[model samples]
Target chain A: AQRVTQPEKLLSVFKGAPVELKCNYSYSGSPELFWYVQYSRQRLQLLLRHISRESIKGFTADLNKGETSFHLKKPFAQEEDSAMYYCASFDNNDMRFGAGTRLTVKP
Target chain B: GAGVSQSPSNKVTEKGKDVELRCDPISGHTALYWYRQRLGQGLEFLIYFQGNSAPDKSGLPSDRFSAERTGESVSTLTIQRTQQEDSAVYLCASSFPPGPQQFFGPGTRLTVL
Candidate 1:
């Protein structure tokens, strides 16, 4: 069974501080990872995918094959960055999501 | 140009009743997916449909839950004898074939009393 794990339910950080949302996965084969975000009153949207290796909204995630992790990172957190972040893994035509982490960037 | 859309943004029903939720994928999208999100939990994959092929219903929680898609257009998820635990925001997403990215709908909020 494939699984995505996001250990933090809630994470708070002051503006301009670095932010890291932890995500780990369990899979036997090569995995396709993604970071999805949902802002206040906004529909869920794709932030980025490992295959793209591109950053959106100043956030980037690197798939660490050795650690089996794909943690999303940002150098400087912005107040608008506050939102719910979900880490997901795609395998065998199915996508599995983590419990999600609520990120709050205080100004 | 429109994104995925779901009907009956909100539905409230009594326990043991049946309810149907609808989703219309983006035009020309060949892959459609259904997911369930509890109040404070992540999205749980319920099912996926590709073109006119048979859908992957492996993620469905129980036998009481079933879904159907008309060709590659609208899809309906039906829940029989709904329970309180069945309450959640059911989301629908669609993607093009060979594309990993999925576009999501606003979701339907289902409540069972």
Candidate 2:
């Protein structure tokens, strides 16, 4: 089974506009969810994890078990926020990632 | 003090040739993992190593791909009889045991012709 799912391949939002990146997982157990970001020519780094429940760079994600979704949302997008975002789930000592969403926040 | 580092940042090999990629995890991190990402694709879990425990090799795609970690430190992923489809960026990440927060390397871009 595909452990993680990201429906959108690319998302574009204007500065100051709201943006949401959808992510869903198929792991049956309480797998840890994480959001990772990679800027151009940079190594992939952890943006935030569901376990922390803390917002980083104005981005927050809620784990909705009923829907099995952990959608990342930000009220106002910034150009610096533009990068590649990947949703990942860790289970059974393995981390599975989605196809990723290339977020472009235009000015 | 150094982050995860992968050697041979980029490699280009001919088809059917074997290639070895190396990774050096952070000190004191007993957990090491190898992953890869093809162009326009997501991260693909390749293998996981923790402490002295047996590695979880189930994620390996085939017998052609294998990895080894010595004394819970550096690791190397070897691919035998590489094919064009094997062209991708191989990434390495490491963290403390049972920690979900992994520090990733810059990744090695392998191009098989």
- Best model per lDDT: 1
Candidate 2 chain A has its poorest 10 consecutive residues by lDDT at A89-98
| Per-residue lDDT of B101 in model 2 | 88
Give the CAPRI class of candidate 2: high
**When superposed on Cα atoms, how far off is each prediction in RMSD?**
1.0, 1.0
Instruction: Please give the DockQ score of every candidate, comma-separated.
Output: 0.72, 0.80
Give TM per candidate: 0.98, 0.97
Off by over 4 Å in 1: none
Q: For candidate 2, what is the lDDT?
A: 0.93
Compose the digit string of candidate 1's lDDT tens values, residues A1-107: 99999999999999999999999999999879999999998889999999989989999999999999999999999999999999999977979999999999998
Quality of candidate 2 docking, DockQ: 0.80
Deviation (Å) of A98 in candidate 1: 0.8
How well is each residue in A1-107 modelled by candidate 2, as lDDT tens digits? 54899999999999999999999999778999999999999999999999999999999999999999999999999999999999999876768899999999999
Off by over 4 Å in 2: none
